[model samples]
Target: MAKNKGSSRKGLMLVVLLLVLALGAGGANLYVLWSQSGKTQASELEDMPAAEPVPEPPHYVALEPFTVNLQSSQYDDRLLYVVITLGVADEQSKQQIEDYRPHLRSRLLMLLGEQEDEALLASGGRQALAEKVLALFDEPFAERLTAPQVKEVLFTEFVIQ
Candidate 1:
């Protein structure tokens, strides 16, 4: 009789534990559903105003590769060999770049020559240099073109020695 009672008690305990776990799982599911119910309706959001169209970026020509001098420190003696690509946005810009190629080349060469030895060592330094080159297309060269013509400056080859 005592053995039978003990078996029944163990079975009841197992049932209680199972019930508690099931209730916990059910509560968690209910909480998740309750939290998600407050979100905005997707169908209503679809009725908002349409977005404006983005203008297409102009295309330009890539120039030939060239080498430029770079300033260096005692620890690292380095010379930079850079291959540059020029973007000519319009006919005027093209003409201007052609007309002033000597001046532009001289300025670029000077700019590159003044760069720090560690400048090329940084990850984003090339991008910064590209931006600087693009800025030149906008300033004095603006009058010759309808707009600032050069869109990008690509470095095909960059070596530090």
Candidate 2:
């Protein structure tokens, strides 16, 4: 009976040891798989094409205030005082606009001077005026074959009297 008991205790110890070994092997396998997955992901990222760089914000160029006499049917004369700020596509466009400031101002004055007071005072007039201004700026300068990229025409101050 004592021998049988000793043999039974040895059998139990062997079973426990085998269980521990199996668990250790399983853990090592899992660790290897996890490490290999991380390496694969790293390699995939390296193989992918680089993303495009973020675009720059729009640049603004503010022009000096313009005051012009508005064409009026009435005996009383009318005037328009406005401040224009241009949103250019790039630095080059801004530079081009600055370089041709005098010519631009002259053209703008002529355009503004042709405006009727009643028409300018009407609703949607400001929007229409902005569109016209944008079109005017779209024209190419004498020095450059390509037009300066004028993205937007903003009216900072608009007053008609």
Best by TM-score: 2
Error (Å) of candidate 1 at residue 42 is 36
lDDT of 1 by residue, 87-115 (tens): 66666676767776776787788878888
Per-model lDDT: 0.74, 0.92
Model 1: colliding residue pairs = 78-161
Model 2 local distance difference test score: 0.92
Model 1 score (lDDT): 0.74
Q: Name the regions of candidate 1 deviating beyond 4 angstroms.
A: 1-59, 141-148
* Sequence-dependent TM-score of model 1: 0.54
Candidate that would win on lDDT? 2
